[model samples]
Target: MNIEKARFNMIEQQIRPWNVLNQEVLDMLIVVKREDYFPAEQKSLAFFDTELPLPDGSKAMTPKLEARILEELALKKQETVLLIGAGNGYLAALLAYRARHVTVLESSSDLRDLAIGNLANNHVSNVDVVLADAFSFKHTGTYDAIVIAGGLEQVPEQLQKQLNTGGRLLAFVGQLPTLTAQLQTRTSGTDVSTRNLFETVVAPAVGAAPVSHFSL
Candidate 1:
């Protein structure tokens, strides 16, 4: 398959119709070159509307879903973003093109190395890939936005606390067959507003903060 043609189809056929109509995003998608991030063997599936496998039993989120999350975040030129699962640094590279900077936290050491290498190969300088467990990583400070690249069983309080006041988080919540892509934003004071973008399922996020038991 021709890479350019596949990319055009991905942007026009799958993403744009899903309300990812931002010109900047569409242009960025074209510029970033998703095919470069995939393994050389799997490069052909880079623009296909399917999840591509990673080294450590993980998978990259489908192109359409990634684009939808990008649209929902509504990234600004100077805003900082926190990416929970850095897979192959594909999404971070995309966010880096729009946001001022991106800090990616990944649990697997091998993935962390792959992400760093991929970002460097793509000349994506605005991203910092960290090897850490997402569930317990301390919120060194808040960010303008947070993106979870994988689905979660539940949103953890620590991750929620990392959001700067007025910051937004895009995540896939719940399990397969009933999962929802949710956009959560922190408003003034202590209010949080959530909107469901659509229904989808991707790989599950590992190392999320554990839920407390309430035994009576």
Candidate 2:
């Protein structure tokens, strides 16, 4: 397969139509070599417009969705980022290019090792991969941006508190069959503003707080 051609086709066909127009983001999508992060058996599906499964049942977000999140965050070279659900470290690799530093939290040991190895092999020095439950991990410092790389019924307020004032968070919120990809921005120490960016369904973050159901 012609990898470069496949990459271009993915950007032009799948991502661009989804409104990912940022030149830098488009360029990074080309440079990131996403195939490097996929499991060897799944490399052929690296650019496909669907979620790719990872070890331990986690998933890499679709290319267009990843691009959309990156564009929405508008990361700065001076900003620090926190990435939840660092499945295979693909998104963390992407975030590393834009932010000054990134801290990735993963629950599975196998995935944590996979992410660490992939990032190191790619020479991504700015990201720190930690094996910890996203819901229970305590952060020592706040971040300029936080991206939860999966769907959630609701983002816990405790997790939201990890953002610095003026920081932004991207997550897919809601249940299966319907979900909204929303960006929550910390307007102040105590205030947050949310804007729905698009609609998509993704696997839930491992160990995410489950939604309550009331049956009649």
TM per prediction? 0.92, 0.94
TM-score of 1: 0.92
User: lDDT (CA) for every model shown?
Assistant: 0.84, 0.88
lDDT per residue, candidate 1, 40-91, as tens digits?
A: 8999888888888889888888888878878889999989999999888888
What is the alpha-carbon RMSD of candidate 2 to the true structure? 1.7
Cα misplacement distance, residue 68 of candidate 2 (Å):
0.9
The clash count of every prediction, one per candidate, is 0, 0
Error of model 1, residue 43, in angstroms = 1.4
Q: List the residue pairs that clash in candidate 1.
A: none
- What is the per-residue lDDT of model 2 for residues 116-182, given as tens digits with 9 covering 90 to 100? 9999988999999998998887767799999988778888898789899999999888867667988
